[model samples]
Target: MTGPTVSSPHEVTDLAAVTLLVHDRTRRVLGAFLGREQTVAGAARETGLDLRVVHRDVQALRRAGLLRVTREQARAGRPVKMYRAHADDLFVDARHLPQQAGEGQAAALDPLFHHAVAREFRRALSDFSPGWGLRVYATPDAPGFAVLEGPRSARRLSPLDEWQGPPARMLSGTPTAHLTTAQVTEVQRDLILLMRKVAEFSAANAGAGQPVLLRLGLAPLTEDELRNLHR
Candidate 1:
């Protein structure tokens, strides 16, 4: 039997749908079905999730209109249902949600975001190789940073046993700057524009390069929060 019609770039505006999509497990189940049909058992295998968890996620996704049963296969006792995503891409819009709902979305996403960042950092360190540097530059329009790969000849040439430790080191620092309201707004605008450009670049280079994670965060601290930093 033919499945329901699938589309590209599904626009998700329902609050229920948005809530489901924010979850990592639901996304994993939906991803397993995207561009292909799969049974609950099959999705569990592909995602390495428990069968019961996959079943629950699939049901939730179907109810959210993010998934559809494509067909049913006749088996010995019952028919096994096949499922597929409603669209290859999903664009979730939560701007219309109430303040409480928006906060809930953020709370749901916070752990997943941090987990992804941490996973990528661990992966990078595991595959760490020497010979890279960060280049910071500022043009009249904006300031930016780039990770520059050093030449192979300049890379670690010593034998493993001769080295004292891993030559690569992580670069990170947290510096707080006090600014006027207008200055804060300007910085936020610049960060938004930078994120947009990064998104465009990722789309342009999709499927052509190694996977990389880029995360940006900007937040203003309250007086109490700022004071707590010292204690």
Candidate 2:
């Protein structure tokens, strides 16, 4: 779906440009290179798209201000230009979005929080070893959190316990809704408190133990996914 066409001429113009990038093929190209830098040939290889097609889309995305030249490779013939999706994510204003009061506030805040997290996560990945891996948390009971842990490259497929000694990890709550809203709030508050304590402990014990990139997030679950889970 396209974003809302608004009053400002510039906003309308910008929306049109962004809508083009949301086309199927262009979207595929963007997804293929979203988190990593790649040459046109490399992107084509990754997406199984024709090189000429990738070349055209990449230029279009560049002009639309979605992709950027990350760097170039000195190939035998021409300097191979490397491109990457600079837009970590996109936000489109939908007029039909649920109009419940405060939904707009939450909608606006969501991207700011998420993109900030993405920026930090990318920074951590770039600096950490390759064995680290992404861990996702979800439940039907409440909003879930995702944590990134490390010592090795996240790109590796090893299980958490196998690599280094067991780091301080905790998981709780169930996929069923047995608790009241107050109970859920209490659990969330407790989790945050525990994490704060851990931060204090971590700061005091920094460098004395195995180094790891620790993170946590709590976000709403998609109703559609929860429905699928029941099946």
Candidate 3:
């Protein structure tokens, strides 16, 4: 049988809609409905979320116009409402969002990205074997390694005590420094060049390497945060 028909990408321009779509749970609920119609219970089961939580997220998504009730399914107690995503994908246009709202949206979306990276790392660790090692080159200047002899080696690793994974390449770092505005601008330009080079390399060697997710971010520290660093 054919699957449910999904419309093309939906363009979301409303600030409220953008805010709602960036929320982690709302995104997950909408994902569960994309390309298929599903009841709240089905979404809950697929996402492994609580039934009440899924229902609440669905209602919020519906109100945001990101989801729609497609049909009703006959069930034992009552007719179950089947929901589908309004489109197969969402294209958010926040170019005109107010400064404060844009910042709020970024803050709301940051954790979701972090969670994705953490989840991938955990999954990689699940297949870990003895004598495996993890090497992280946070930056060209600083490198770190966590070698695992076996499961029992966890106790000697301190902060990385719980880390166990096959040989892998990873980059992560949060380096704070004081810099002039011009220096920061130069660094930003270099970062852009680095991103372009990475993209070009990936395109040139498309099928040779496994998929990897890369996230890059830069921001100045708040005055309060900087002050705390000295204490």
RMSD of each: 13.1, 18.4, 13.6
Tens-digit lDDT track for model 3 on 1-231?
999997667789876668777677777878999999999999999999999989988888888888899999897998989999988778876674455744776786668667766776566566665433443323334344433333433334444533433333554456688899999999999999989998998999976896665667779988899889789
Superposition TM-score, candidate 2 onto the true structure: 0.35
Full-model lDDT, candidate 1: 0.72
Candidate 2, residue 111: how far the Cα is off, in Å: 37
Q: Tens digit of lDDT per residue, candidate 2, span 1-231?
A: 999975432222365456655466888888877778888888889889999998988888888877889888897998988888766656545552234535666777767655665665556556654434656544455556445444443343356443432232322223444466787788789879978897888899976875444344444456786687689
lDDT of predicted model 2:
0.64
Residue 184 lDDT (model 3): 94
Measured by TM-score, how close is model 3 to the native structure? Answer: 0.44
Order of candidate numbers by TM-score, starting with the best: 1, 3, 2
Query: Best-fitting candidate, measured by lDDT?
Result: 3
The candidate that wins on TM-score is 1
